[model samples]
Target chain A: MFAAQAFASLFSSPAKTSSPSLASDHPTGGQAAHHAKPLFFTTPHHLKLTYFPIRGLAEDIRLILEESGIAYESENISFHDWHEGGIKQQRAADNPFGQMPILYVNKGEFILSQSKAIIRFIARSTGLDGGDAYSAARCDQLAEGIADLRRQYATLAYDKEFAAKVGDFINKTLVNSFTTIERVYDQNKTRYLLSQDRVSYADIMLFELVDQILALGQDARSVVAKFDRIGEVYKSIAARPRIAAYLASSRRVVAINGASASVGAFKA
Target chain B: MSGDGKYHVHYFAGRGLGEIARIALSEAGVEFEDHRFESLPADLKATTKFGQVPLLVTPAGDRINQSTAILRFIGATHGLSGKTALENAEIDQVIEGVNDIRAKYRALPADAANEERIKFFSTVLPQWLGYFEAILKKTGSGFYVGSNVTIADLYVYVSFDSVINKTADAQPIDAFPLVKAHLEAIAARPRIAAWIAKRPVSQW
Candidate 1:
């Protein structure tokens, strides 16, 4: 079935190049030859990512762009000033939901809000989502898992008894969440989360989530070390050349609390 | 189903996360085993990738969890997903929007007082349903995205159905006529109607 779909796609028009196929292989000669195409057309639009001057939700999108080798402008809006009537009205006016982490594809022609939606859009365009339906489902599952973990962490961070019951939270919530993630990695037995050879958006999300957990002053290393496969996947994603460069560059904002919080209430 | 592989849907006996995929599979005219659990088996619970229900064991025996992922997989495989990226984006937006409302309802404490539920029914339900109504209005094609019945329609239908009819002490949803009409339209589909008639009943 997979082979038949591949064979059919080779002859299909470029317009039929769906998200799954785009994530797998380049368009065939027949499709490209029939159209006027540039040598480098991976990113078909002038991309712009708008968010706060923090790696809160936009960091995963940034990592995906870097991994896909797409050049995009990162416009970090100041959270404090934006709240204090600095572009607040304009920002709300521009976004349908009045939220940050908006992606302006083709400059300002197409606008997309919501971090997950933007991530999926960029992931599909850049071929980082997954190659097929099943793989894509796995990618979505892993990404949702990351979102669930982030939500739990946020709940703990805002809990009034958080400071007092930090140990209990770590043991019950954090460890259990990491265990589930570890099991996912172990079950897949892949270098990345879903794919054996390729790095999907889920890997990037997991890496960022783990990094945030570590940033929260929790002993993330110890928790993840128990799960060798997850640790390896984490190290592999961080060691990606572009990701490594981004991590070391000034472009990477330091983790902060309040407006710049990516991994709970923690200050870098 | 076109594929020769077997299908097994693992979920609790209730029509929770699994109903959307179940409806999609039925809509695709696929035959599969429905594994309903009153209480999750120890081994299955431990072995599930995410330690959750609504896990889909594909014909090839790949255990996939997460309701949205299952919905997307079935949609993509059975020609229920959107035909284009933009259409897919719009579909995803509706799915996410419905999920946002579901999340809000889930966040309410299980032991909450009647006043909270009343508030949710009065303010929150209408606000979210109004958004979906506006979406239906914008499309004007009677579908969530594009000109056909996609998985987004199934999701929204299942969500609205559960909230309006299935939930204990459910509230009336007559304010959003478009949404109610959309629900009626989907419910009238042959396969979906069959599933609705024969599926196990549960108090959600």
Candidate 2:
């Protein structure tokens, strides 16, 4: 654990250090030597992240890029613009799933799509994947659960009877959805999902989801507070200087989703 | 670890999320116990951290949920994943691409005559399939990632197989020649074909 923490710090605040061989950095190397090659991204790599004109699936990604001080621009595409011969449509044939939130890496050398893929890529490129393959696998597992939670939130938000059904969803369904997260936190006894002092992809993703839930005001806040460890993760992540600044900056995405009739935090 | 030890994979009898991991283990020629259930028993469910299926009880006795996580573990140790973070991301994007279509395809009302389903089979499904077809063309490697077969290929093959017949035309695969051929190619691999033939029969 000590070595893992030290490995994490080397990448968390990346320096222009010489590359370390995979075998030297990872004592448990060979099998995962390929997967564990950490890219020390002292400079921005994800040049542009394009998504719908809402937080939707891109907020966690935005959080990572900002916290790492990686320079990138966000391009928001409206539904109309996507269908109106815009850049999104132009890139559709190449875009994975022909969807928004595609990343333009290093000035479009590689155009990567899919939110989860982008999140992991940014986490890896910026050293947030928990330092080794095992911890990285655990981080991936927790992040998958958060993706499921986000999907549930989206499903309810887009429900035809959202106005009538949202109260029940916020009060009951979401609380149940969070049980595994709370359990993971309890079992780890860490301030963050994977580490006590370091932030991982899961922490960023959970923070993004919690931010939306908290934005729903007192009731939502109280429900989240019910999971004390989750609250700690949220506070610790939001307190990071860059993350804090990003949240306070004009670029903070206020909408939890795209144009849904009654999405809790969709600003419109 | 190089996945030298045995493992136990738990899931429903049906070939859903669990099938991918099963296919991966079989492909890697790793020995493991395959536990299937009609539904997760309460006792078994209690042991799962999330009360979910497709849990892989590891060689180390760790209970891992999330099909992706299990696949990642297998992939990393079994030479079925990419060589670098970038390569893995590229591989993962393909799976996420399949997932994106699967979610939308699942949400369509089940009525065979529904107009939305009609539009989906004719437009949406084809649209998504074309993206994959183009991916194959771009890679031109006969595999989703790298020169060798990865979990990305298996994932796309399994996911598309389950949903491609939803409305016949609604989930069309014929027009995308590369995707259609890719599916057939994957289905015909000796080990994969043996597993497919011997695996349990399920509607889904």
Candidate 3:
């Protein structure tokens, strides 16, 4: 089935110049000669990411690019750049959401102010889309869970009763979330959430959650130690070769808490 | 705020709907005009868009509305959206879910919303959390959508951290394993680590 799909994909796409048969037979004599390069090859996939100087949201796309092995230029501009230049201004004018993280592809820009949209796009290009509809939905559903977690945390983080609310949130909503996740881990026979094999973006996301919990202040470890499965998964992904290497590489990082208080502004 | 090139996001300084767009630019590595209003923007009342302040302006001076549309446009052109149709759809669905819950939270004021919020967080959220946990139960794989990272994961992590780490009246973190494990994974990312380290310090 996979082979048949691959063959179909090959034939469906325009012939490439690299194919000797097509190159020899066309001789500027047929439709093949008119359009030999693959449709995707017809245009370059250069991307320009527009956001604040901080990594408040774009990190996921960066991770996907690194994982996919696609080399795209990263144009780090400042807020001043947008005010000083009209292109950035016009780009946002075109934005329905009137936000940053507008991506310029081949000089033709497609804007997605939501962080998940951008990350998912990058993941798909990297062949990260999972096997079936259910699996894919599961991945999305997990992502939703993460979003919920962030919203809850954001509210509590800002409340004057930080200690009280944050602690309550951790004990109530967060704990329940983890327990439910633990149940999921058990259901999949202690493998991943979608299936028994193959890692997904959600897996990496889960790893991030655990790390954040552990590293959050001092008592975080104590809070996290309660969930054995979470701890186990954290150790597992942290140990993965690609992820480990990615983590080690300097390209994997940008500003984090420098704009932590800017959570309310994130459309990512 | 008076200039055509100026963009104003009216939300509180904390991470919210605007941060994703802000982060996307950082990842793609471009800068934009930004105005963070501690209080509502003084010119908000005069702005053309209906009372809200989270507005973006173009060089041509066009105004945009809705957060999802903006993110989609940014993701598509910048390669931040997923690689395939399925991945994109999945990301969309997850964002939809996030919206669903965020709407729930938005409906209520901080004090008045606590009870309803608690019920939704403890009950409704768990159901969704369970669904994700099932995905994580898959063998060997660590991600939500596919083997590689996706925006879905980032949003999820951001959302999770918002609840567990940021909120003062937020719920506990011990209840959901899928949620717990997933959070752990996202936090471990180096870029995310950098994000955490560089997060700004504010009174809120």
Runs in model 3 deviating more than 4 A are A1-44, A77-90, A158-161, A195-197, A258-268, B1-107, B110-204
Docking quality band of candidate 1, CAPRI definitions: acceptable
Candidate maximizing lDDT: 2
Per-residue lDDT of candidate 1, residues A129-228 (tens digit): 7655666777899899888887676666566676666566566777888888887777666688756768999999888877876765646556656767
| TM-score for chain B of all predictions | 0.92, 0.93, 0.72
Candidate topping DockQ: 2
| Candidate 3 chain A minimal-lDDT segment of 10 residues | A1-10
The DockQ assigned to candidate 3 is 0.03
Give the Å error, residue A13, model 3.
12
Q: Residue A48: error of model 2 in Å?
A: 1.8
The i-RMS of every model, in angstroms, reads: 8.3, 7.4, 16.6
Writing each residue's lDDT as its tens digit, candidate 2 over A1-268 gives 0012223332322111232223234346423443444473653444788877678788888999888788788887776778785766588654756676888765676677788988887787766886556677788888888898888777877788876776787788778878778888888877887778889888989998998777656777778888888888888899999999999998886777666546544453
TM-score of chain A of each: 0.79, 0.83, 0.68
lDDT of every model, 2 decimals? 0.72, 0.76, 0.53
**Over 4 Å off in model 1, which ranges?**
A1-43, A80-98, A194-197, A218-221, A256-268, B1-4, B111-118, B166-172
Models 1 onward score TM values of 0.84, 0.88, 0.48
Docking class of 2: acceptable
lDDT of 3 by residue, A1-268 (tens): 0012221232233222343232235443221232212322223467666666654456556555555555666656565566577656576433323345555554543334456666665544443545332244445445556655655665655466666666667677778777666655665574666555466776666776665455345465676788777677677766667667777877554443223342233222
Give every collision pair in model 2. B121-B170
